[model samples]
Target: MVLDKFNSVRMLNTDALQADFVIVGGGISGVCAAITAARQGLKVVLIQDRPVLGGNGSSEIRLWMLGATSHMGNNNRWAREGGVIDEIMVENTFRNPEGNPIIFDSVMLDKVVSEPNITLLLNTCVYEVKKSAGHKIESVRGFCSQNSTMYEVTAPLFCDASGDGVVGFLAGAPYRMGAESREEFGEKFAPAEDYGELLGHSLYFYTKDTGQPVKYVAPSYAMDVTKTVPRFRSFNAKEHGCKLWWVEYGGDLDTVHDTEQIKWELWKVIYGAWDYIKNSGKYPEAETMTLEWVGCIPGKRESRRFEGDYMLIQQDVIEQRHHEDAVSYGGWSIDLHPAAGVFGEESACNQWHSKGVYQIPYRCLYSRGIENLFFAGRIISVSHVAFGSTRVMATSAHSAQAVAVAAAMCLEENISPREVYSLGKVSELQKRLSRMGQYIPDMKIRDEENLVKKATLAASSEYHFKGFPADGEMQALDESVAQMIPLHKGDRLGKVKVGLFVSEETLLEVELRVSSKPFNHTPDVTLETKTVSLCQGKQQLELTFEAVMPEEQYVFLVFKKNPLVQLQYTKERITGVLSVFNTINEAVSNFGKQTPKEDIGIEEFEFWCPKRRPGGHNIAVQSEKDCYVFSVSNIDNGIDRPVQSPNAWVAELNDPAPALTVRWDSAVRIGKMSLFFDTDYDQPMETVQMTHPENQMPFCVEKYKIYDGEGRLVYEKTDNHQSINEFVFPEKLVTDEIKIVLEHPSDLIPAALFAVKCYE
Candidate 1:
């Protein structure tokens, strides 16, 4: 043990530890990375600076998990992240449907603890690095304030899931920060001039009604909103939690280095805003509401992004560019926030979506210079323009899973992260990922062991392939409709197509307005509009309006309310779409209703009564109008999962025992059979903010039986969760025919099965 003190610095003795992989940061990305590696039989040590997991989604920060599937919206379609993130999202929905923060923390922690190979060290900050020759990492030293322990962790592989890319920064990996110029990435949305500004940091607060009258007092540090804060004067006492993502600051300064100052400044603003709500004569409704929670940690949006072999740019996202080594995908939109933070009067940020979700490549997951350094989360190698979409937690988590799988391959191949690209190990890596249910855009199952591909699918019940329709149900003429219309980045508003119904001859006016800011959904800035008269009947209307704008956070296409007319919409709640009965009426849009609300159908997101109890859905897809789920077979014709359901064998069931019997032309030795069940493909996963309950879906196959070619019962199971189920045999079943006898299909929709395969 050695101790040294120099001037004003003190160093203490350190402990030594070793693992196959060391993950810095416990955010979704890091957590998923650690789990993936550990699950693949690698030893891992995960170091989180904070006391809890989930990073931004932690109770300390409380930002909900956002990802590749933009809440099952138009852009991303059926995309919900798979692997560990999907597990968390599904579990969180069932156990913590209210999207409770502490519950989310526990869920994430439980997942980490479930992995025996993962060594989790919470409240440990990795501060130093040790590198050896060959440009490879040797070890990293982290300090734990909880126990005053300085520990050195050594690993052959390292992943910087840390959102700030701290490991890459310490390892001398080349990186970039702040906005790029239009000339740098050929991004039209990029600032015409280069700037050292970035998306800001944000703070949030929580408030609850005391039930009885409650008084408020201002702290000494609370700024007087009427004087100190002038730009945002609207301090509604009821608004709290993540609904206030706009309470942002610190973009103009160094978001990483100046984080403390930003925290202090955000504290002032949050406290001041609370004080203004209680002390100011703004409203009498504030009398009963009490300050419930104030954040100590600020939720940071952007920071240092490490350099990788290929830097993804805006055009890649805008054009939905196809990368040869595509590994993961993102579709959250190019969500760029303003540099001025909260003080700026400009739109909070600029955002543009792609035609659809775009592919993220393998080259961007590992460092270009640092031999063993790989990164996930917001730090992945992407231009500032591309980061807007890749930086979300879900996309980063997918990258982490990709890194974890690649790290396993690296261990197997005895190669550096750079070498994997050169040796063409990416295809194998992609195969491994998809077999595990991670959806890589355009990547499909092509393995010869997928025996079902060569078999004849026979079922007792017939699955009538209905042509998918744009509109499923007739909505009642109850309220005005305004949907968030997203455009590909830098694209203009060419037109909008909507399904409408008129009970009698009626006149209707549609208005398109740009979202006020990047951080919120309230519409402002009128664009183009039109008025149309329709005869009594159902009609598909196309409203063509021209507008000039770089991009939009979101656009509001407000359809005027008419008593005699109604619009068509899937009652199933689609992600990314926000429904408003009337923003002006407090009752119409209150986050906290006077009484606890009931679990309404995805239909509640609609202004009309939620009547549809979804029988089966991948998610309520807004487009890709086909009666049957699109491109269900493994062959990809541009559209796949999230945009279309997987190629699955489904049946329309009325028989007591319905079955899908796979028969090959000849007998084949089969020792084991695996199946990926059809859980709700369109699972509306939410982390902390939701109006509905996440429950253990009954839509899965609850019971099933297996039979041999002779129709002899071989295996049977009842009460199942839709995870991959594998049946193994001591000796190979030398038969070409196998059958699945299914019972009690939930939701009464089509009985569906995904990824059926036989392996020896």
Candidate 2:
């Protein structure tokens, strides 16, 4: 084979093209920079040396995307955001439902190509950089494999997101290659006195289960597996899907300098280990599972670092120092992989820090010498010891967000990276980040509005009914009877009742509906007799009722039950007297009934049937635990009260029915509220509506409800049904009370409303 080199220097037309910014390296950081700039309406050109976009996480390497932030359900802090990363996640979740690595790579590639503003040059390598006077980068030249052509890319600004800091190195920027001495940076994990060897890299692989016997062949030059000790092991195969081992660290070669050599050694170790497992016959089923990957590119933990405006040191991390320019945060402990030359020892050389978080400043993202250039990802300026903590992909992604935003700001303001550090511009950048949902605790927006109002009710030692008078004198059943009242149970009551009265002059056209699950057994307490006479303009009405106590609880009254009461009774010494009558006034008129009948009179209703539990009559008391209350008064729209269902008759009812209207005296502000309904018997959720009352608009609602078996509505609301009407929140609200009317239009089991959450 003959190596071909055409020429050392090639001239290209400079005036042919122009861009506001140019990004080198199509990794996550570079892509994010380009995307961020483009989203701000800036012209951007992204150049990549490889066919794929993701640097470490790509099909070429098959490395999993790990970050400090939660992706899917993985809760890693400093969760990053760039439309590009979000696009990749969304596409991956759709294309590869199983989340296969190969498909994930494809999703990443799609995002790069789909961005209209991004011009991606694949299979291209940047060879040289040309600068103008005074160390300002002029143009970058690269060799394109696809066209077999060399081109010059000239832009006002450039970003080096390459994991190895290749562009910054060629640009003659100040940088550090290895760890600093313990005394130099005062880093606890640093080498004794001087910077020397660095943490080596690793080549990760995985295997899948096929439930059949298989065999693995060891490489002829493979190291003996019996001699190597496992570093990381997981025995719970079911939890992790399968067994995984990350045993060896160093291959006795510089990962960046001798990548090919390290890859070869890793391949041998993988096959050799598998061969040992297969030959041992300890895992008969292991034969079916094959090595899914060899050494995809070696993942380097340490490399060249571009000197930035500020050098983040280990002390800064260990001290938990806060900076006005803090643009990102990292939580991973200080983990230093064993250095080269320390191999095959009983005690692996490593250092671990206590659980703590660190703040990384924005000044560390730009090149110190290269005024027009910025650096992000693993190559940011930091001592090797500090880099150990910041090198994690999640932190790197956060750094990428900082770099992208700064780059865009630089382009828009016609300034350089150095200018961003002046006049508190860096802090401004940090503020912009905080506004974008980046977790910067110092500038957090907290909810301070009081959601519940303070109220004091008159205490009753003996039952002195205040609202109305009965024809017969009331008898005191027991002293403990007052304690059974839900309102007397202290501040934390699960539910409370508010009375609503309409006079003869008031014409009510209200729609009352409860947003929570309805109850079965009607309360034995009567609200009509409990109502007070209204003075034309205003009237105060009070109702006395009991709520089964669980523990000390907070309760809020949203609605009151009219013509409803609860009965409390206990077993007596007299035998065979198993039932008691807790009745209301005989003359009190029922809503739909023209004349009250003796049998239809309000009486003690038992929650549980006798067949279910014999002699358990005390458990049959019908209180707030057995029914939901909703009311419509002349003053406002409606009120809703969610009660616990003890009778279990309404336990199967998933949605709230439209029985009456709830009117509020004034427009109430609801910051956030959710309505849950049962759609299917299995899922039983029909719909969920979350709205902001102050804005008088819907935040989100689920339309297509889920159902369960037996045609019961499982999930009442569907995703499509739920939608945010507007992004902006208004000051005032249209209606104080939100009416949730359940309609069982479909031939499915009646859906029940489980809960409603109102957050201010």
Candidate 3:
């Protein structure tokens, strides 16, 4: 080491690199975009200002990754966003079911590093953006604080996922900072001036018990929360981290430039809140508890929403409007917070949910003015009311996947983002995204290249609708419960028997209900009601409904709540069968039922949601006639998950060895085979702080073997727990027949598959 001369102006080391895509944020959206782009043969550079990836989802902030599933508090069934984000979430649940934030960090890091086409730069913040002619971004400049090095990254395309829109801001992209007026977009749910236009930033803290009393002293800057915060009494020792998402601030300030000030204010509130818990003598349970970790950076809810070709507005979300170029979907409620944050006297948030998932168009992904710039995450083009639904991590990540695929198409065709629409290539883009497991609502995969379409499919056995056997435990009728049954348009619900334990003679009321719309799961329309007389002890009660299904959809056979009655549950888990309860999950703002004010411009509906595994067993029922079918033709129905029907090929419960065969008139070369399994998409696989009962879905196939025309094993896998499994052969095989042998996760759960795709 040599001593530096005084006043010697030395330049920092500059490193230059080139890539196909430069994503300027390591949040879930950016991480997903990078992974998807890299997988599509694009060289990518992922830049993160923080020390780790996952942005708000990282350990530094610890916000749970949520989206369409909406905490299982709404009626959106099988609604988890898919693609790269799904893989990351599944991996997190398998490795860290305890939901430790640090372990989640490693999961994200591992996925990104595993891709050879990606170069990740952590602790590097992009500060400058260089633009070339024709409004295209030429390069970006970033500096790493830890290494004291500056990096100049050049790429054909750039993605601005930096929550605050740093690249878009410096690139002169049109954006909106606050909420838009109601007249501007016909948005009736627009916030008033008093409620504040912008959503705020929040900081979270975590606590734990040391098994001994711990003392805490307030700093000089710690404000007295008891005196300053109106909702101070709401704070307790039981909840921490994102559970206290309402513990927020900085909505009234410049969320971007004044972030440090907002962070300091949040710190003051957190410390003061802790001080009250310890010194105010209100929380005796907190005596042995101490602060384990507190977030230094705040999680921003909204910032600069940049402009795109078509801006998504309120009607797009509330009305579930269809888009021609639909590339993704969002199902989370329109959730907005007050500007005053924790200090506000009003309720922490106002959330309005839609009847079903709505499509997100591709036009809202790329910048309207900038040629090569793409917007990801909360900064995408959406009005304030629509943003309330699309701003969540999973939804944003889903949209980012659309951007990744669009970027790949752009590189392939050497065209601008707008040209993709002008040239009528959106369908091709959708097909590619669907192949990668990106869920686009109401859109089916129509790939002509899939060889399975030209072949005949047959299964060894198909499950017939009998009933769930009464072999599992029983639970009290503490809440209203219903069993979802699938029916054809003209089918009538016949006599059904349910096993129940009645304490005494009771008149149980059974009602048959269905959703007004075929796509919705909310049982809003009641068709028939039957009063069944039940005696004491365990007995079977027969119920018959004179109602015929209006369309091909799911109908709910509901049992009214009776405290003296208990219903028997079965261990069998199926792909599209679930028992939902009329209950409250306050985390997602589902308070049993939603009854909004007349002028709020929101819908009123009941929340019928499924419970997590190890508890969400199906109710025992018996029927003389078959009501549901699991045909082998469902494997090539284009639809992956269950929508109007089961959309899955399920084996019979007694099938010892379930197998599927595909045959052709002549041998054809096949290079790759993709199989879509049932991973219980209805449950929200929260990325952090939410423990799951099981790592692998009970309906998923655990092991499988594939054989060719010669009866030689081509590929086999065990210990599988992913929604999609792809096998690429090193040498293309010519086979007239292909057979797949499957193994169920357990005896109770049968082997099931959504779709099978083979390509040459």
Candidate 4:
């Protein structure tokens, strides 16, 4: 190697590259955008300032990824975001069930690099942007510190996913920081100046046990918890990482420019908290415990929100307003943090839940003025109050997916981003996204080319409305419990029988409840309430409600709280069915019910949530007559999850070999096939800090085989653990008939499929 010695100043090595799409910041949103665009055959360049991807979810700053399935603590059932983010989540759960941040980093890297169309540049920061005529971005300049190289990447379309809107700012995109006035958007939930304007930044640390006495020396900059932190007494040696989410600062200051200052304050607070645990003598249990790992970088929550054609406001979320250009959905509550952050006297956050998930319009994804620019992550177009709900990682990633697909379409048509909406192409975009497993509320996949749509479908056996067998443990009715059973329109739920064990003779109260809205899962409207006397023994009680369902939806057979009574649970796991208990899960701030002040502009509703796996058994209940709809035609309903109805065809529990056959009058050619399976969308697969009991979902299909018209095996798969299984044939498959044979996930669980699509 020859070393260069020059009298003149030498510049860094410069490289020029061109791509169809250029995305700055390798966060979850950017990663998802790159993967999606790459999958659509676009040459993409993904740039990251950090060494690894997953911005907030990276090992350097480990924050759990969450979205619509808000910790599974709210009434939004089966509300997980889909598409590339869904694949990443399912893959993370399968490979890193333990939720190691390092492993998660690898998972992100693996996904991005696995796509040949994507070129990832880690440890690279974009500092310059070049714009062309007509307000379009032509290129961006970035530098990699490790390689000491300057890269000028030119692309037709550009996306800004950086946490602070770096590219958007440099490109002169109009944006707003902090809160908007209540009168501006008529948002009553908007924060007052005294309360807070902008949400703050948070830093987290992890601790572990050393199995011996360990000591720690606080740095000179370490803060004094007793003096500086008002909530210092709340600190416990057991709490670590994101559990200390309240350990935040930098909201009152310039979050973007003063990030370093904020990070220093966070570090001081963390060290001081640890010092109190080790030196304060308040915890004898901490003697053997020591600091295991600390986050190097802080997880930033909010900064500058850029402008788009439409700015999502408070009412859009609370009212569950539908958007014709809807591309994604969000269910997280309107969460806001105080500007004073960890040092504030106010509550750490104020969250208000809506009745159901709301649609995110495509107009809010791309910049309003910048013709070629797109917005992703926390920087998307929304009012400050609405940002509280749309700022989560999963929601951001899901929205960014819309950008990826739009960018691909733009490149193909040689048009601007706004033209995709103005030209009436939103429906086609929605259909494409749904086919790729992106869930859009009230939107159905209308792919006319799907071969299954024109074929006759039949299943070997269908699951009738029978009660779950009493095979699991008994659960005490300390809190209200409800079994979510699906009922069709005009169907009458006559009499129901439930197995219960009573300690003493007591009065039992039962109620039949449903949501005021059809798509909502909240059991707010009570149809009928009945009171019955119980004896002190294990017996089946008959509950006669005789309530007629006006519309097709999931009704709750609610059992009121009774300490003396215990309900029987069954081990069977079925798609679109679950048991919810009215209780407190402080993690997501669900305290059994939300009783907000009437003037706060927030509605009051009870929160009935399901438990995690290895538990959350179904309640054993039998109906006098079958009312559930589980037909073979459901497999072609264009819906992949349970919405107003159970959109799945489930085989009977006793069927030894479950099979579904499709027949066509004439032979059809299929070049690709996609299968949708049950993966329990209710389970919020948090990427970090949460450990799951099993590597794969118990309801996911593990084995299946597909046969053609000639009774010859076309394809077979085993060890399947994902919700969407896709196969592309090198040679087209021509057949007049197709058969699918499946093995039950377990003896107690039935075989279920949401939808099937065969495309040419």
TM-scores across all candidates? 0.79, 0.57, 0.98, 0.99
TM-score of 1: 0.79
Residue 109 displacement in candidate 1 (angstroms): 1.2
- Which whole-number lDDT from 0 to 100 does residue 124 have in model 4? 93
Output the better candidate (2/4) by lDDT.
4
Q: After superposition, how far is residue 468 of candidate 2 from its true place, in Å?
A: 36
Give the range of the ten consecutive residues with the poorest summed lDDT in model 3: 621-630
Number of the candidate with higher TM-score, 3 or 4: 4
How does candidate 1 score on lDDT?
Answer: 0.70
Q: lDDT for model 2, please.
A: 0.47
| Count of clashing pairs, candidate 2 | 85
Off by over 4 Å in 3: 1-9, 535-537
Best by TM-score: 4
What does candidate 4's lDDT look like per residue over 1-760, in tens digits?
7757764888899999999999998999999999999999999999999999999988989999999999998899999998899999999999999999999999999999999999999889999999888787899999999999999999889999998999999999999999999999999999889877888889998889989999888889889988988889989988888888899898888989999999999999999899998999999899999888878788999999999999999999998998999999999999998898888887888888988899999999999989999999999999999999999999999999999999999988888899999999898889889888998987777787788999999899999976787888888999999999999888777888888999999999999999999888999999999999999999999978778887889899999999999998888878888899998988777899988876667788999999888878999888888755888989988888988877999999899989999999999998999999988888899999889998788888899999999999999999899899999988999999999999999988889999899999
**Backbone-clash count (model 4):** 0
Kindly give the number of clashing pairs for every candidate.
Answer: 14, 85, 0, 0
Candidate 3 matches the true fold with a TM-score of: 0.98
Q: Please list all clashing residue pairs in model 4, or write none if there are none.
A: none
